[model samples]
Target: MKISNETIIEMYEKMVKIRKFETRAMNLFAEGQVGGFVHLYIGEEAVATGACESLRDDDYITSTHRGHGHILAKGGDMKYMMAELFGKETGYCKGKGGSMHIADATKGILGANGIVGAGHNIATGAGLGIQYKGTDQVCACFFGDASTNQSTFHEGLNLASTWKLPVVFICENNGYGISVSQARHQNITDISQRAVSYNIPGITVDGNDVFAVFEAVQEAVARARKGQGPTLIECKTYRWRGHFEGDPTVYRPEGELEQWKKKDPIPRVEKYILDNQVMTQAEMDKLNEKIDALVEEAVDFALASKFPDISSAVEDVYTDIVEEGRSR
Candidate 1:
């Protein structure tokens, strides 16, 4: 499917936004401006950009720990995200949930989970909701390679398949699950093959190629809207940073990082934009400037925002529970 130039430009912008946000996040975490651990989505930009681009505003997605890219691509507000990372009252979860738990229900982003393979059940549940509501909406579940081994992965896929839930399982096989490589952990070469058990369409594509991902997901979303069932899309990509920001990644093979760096998705997409003349260099530069200013503004907003009041700590935990001794 030929995506429009406008959409392509928007995709490019989203990819850049993810790159810039994570890059800044790395710095902020190091400088102690942001608390908690941060997992950078430095090289895996295309998968989220392409997949989310095919989604509508009401469509749902469950994100992984390395989920800033998914949220940004799905129209998450940067200021709120920055504030969340800064643990300010203006955050998405009012400073209660940190980086790995940022959620925007209005935007259909369920939440970025810290637990491995936790999103599978959530995405399937969202799909069930869509089916029950008789809506054309679908949920894209983004997970890492290691998540495929989790019991939730099997259980969720089984139920979704049996019920014909409209959930697209997007596995980002970045070669490593925390510190373990795919070869050392799993015997299967392609994680997509797991879908065979569920009798769903499973395919692997170059996660670095946004077009490949977009077209594949477009087809899957079409099939889902027609009540066809779920699809498993394994995106073979790499994570530039270690599992978390501070991980030295000693387990990585010599020169492996350099090898994957050659496949960086952002530069390749930028090249595609230039080759297609989707926008002139001047226009692209203007877009970059706009995104840069936006990131800076988000940082400023987070810095200026006040921390949540002490009473707010006990507020959002349970639906209706209140602290016995605490008075508001």
Candidate 2:
């Protein structure tokens, strides 16, 4: 299917939002405005934008620790996300979950988990729900390349394939798991090839190219909605920042970060927009200004929101069990 110019504009806006949000997050984390660990989605904007663009609002997605981009791409509210980061009462999780655990059930975002590779389980379960309900809905599972080595990854794929579940496994191959590079940690060069073991379609694409990602995911999502089962898509991209905000990224090879920056997804899309006359530079300028204002408002909202009360720590902990004789 041919992508429309309007969708291209939407993709550009989403990519810019991801970039600006991450940049703001970095500054806020440095100033101690955001508590707890934060994993910035600085360079992998295209993957989330492209994949989520192919999905419907009723479809589900499971996110990782490095998940702000995924949630935002899937229509999460910036005000709520910012508030969550600020540990304020207005947050998505009532300010308790912090950076790694934001969720919006209405948006079909299961949650951004803190544990590595945990999303595989949640996404597979969501796929099961879709199958059981006899619905055409599909689940998109987003994870880092490193998580593919975990038991959950294997188990999720096996079960999804066995049941012919509607799940799309998306691996953002940013080439690092905390300080460890992909070459140093994993044996396989192409993680997508692992899909062969479960008899599913698998493919690798340039994660920086939003169009490539959109096309690939669109096809997979169509297949999934048609009950054709799962597809494993590995997006070869890079993270611009360290694993978390505080860590020194000295483990990265010299000039490596810069080289990846040269392939930065945001600018590439911008160039395409201009080159193809999809939109003029002036229109893009207006779009940037609009995004800038939106981000600023989100920051202001977070700043203005009140912090969560101390007594509310255990409020949403469980559904059925009461806390030490407290009422359910």
Candidate 3:
């Protein structure tokens, strides 16, 4: 898929928004608003932006705990996402799902999974649904490097491959899977190479380059739509924040995190925008200013939003078994 100038600009804006959202959410976490495990996507904006840009609006995507980027790139509402992170009543899950579980099914985002590799099966099922319904919609499941070790990853990959389900298993290899480095966990250097076992094509791309990811994922989506089976894409990316808020990060070696920070996806995309003349610096600045304002408004909306009521703890919990005549 050839990317036009507008698409490039859109990609840049999406990456910028992810960076801003993650940074602001960190501040809210410190302020005691954002709840649960907060995994910021500071250095890995390009992977989500690029891969999602290649997808259609109606396509299905499953996300990881560090999923704010994937959700935002897949067209999730910023205000509602902010509310969810804040655990407010206006959240996507009405203050229940929190950081790791934010989702918007209508936008084709299945959900973000807290359990490692659980989303793989979900995307596989969604792919089967699309196939049964005879739709071109594909499922993109974004997971971590550590999840590649899970049995479900293999099971999901084999199931989709054997059935020829249209699913893209995107492994965002951000070096560490909650403090355990990829080197210590997996013997194979690149997780994409595992695709050989399932007889599916696997490719490792520079996750720092949004264009590279966009091009690679575009081909995979096309192949899936044409009845080709799933492809395992291992994106070599990095994150700037600790796994969660308050993580001591003792597992990280000295100067490693700093080195990855220098390869920030935001600046890389910005440089591409400038070098290609996709947008002038002034226009890019205006775009950033608009995104910043929108992010601020989202934060205010989340702050002003109410928390879910305590009396309704069991209201939606067992709706199926409860009688419909009961009043709120």
Q: Top model by TM-score, which number? A: 1
**To one decimal, what is the Cα RMSD in angstroms of model 3 from the true structure?**
2.2
Which of the two candidates, 1 or 2, achieves a greater TM-score against the reference? 1
Write the residue-wise lDDT of candidate 2 on 218-323 in tens digits: 9999999999999999999999999999889999999999999999999999999999999999999999998888888999999999998676865666886545
> Can you write out model 1's per-residue Cα lDDT over 117-176, one digit (the tens) per residue?
999999999999999999999999999999999999999999999999999999999999
What lDDT score is found at residue 233 in candidate 2? 97
Candidate number with greatest lDDT? 2
The residue ranges of model 3 lying beyond 4 angstroms of the native Cα positions read 322-328
Give the per-residue lDDT of model 3 (tens digit) for 216-278.
Answer: 899899999998989999899988788988888999899998888787777887887789888
Weakest lDDT window of 10 consecutive positions for candidate 1? 319-328
Backbone clashes in model 3, listed as residue pairs: none
**True-vs-predicted CA distance for residue 165, candidate 3, Å:** 0.3
Task: State the displacement of the C-alpha of residue 212, model 3, in Å, after optimal TM-score superposition.
Answer: 0.6
TM-score of each: 0.98, 0.97, 0.96
Residue 279's C-alpha lDDT in candidate 1?
Answer: 88
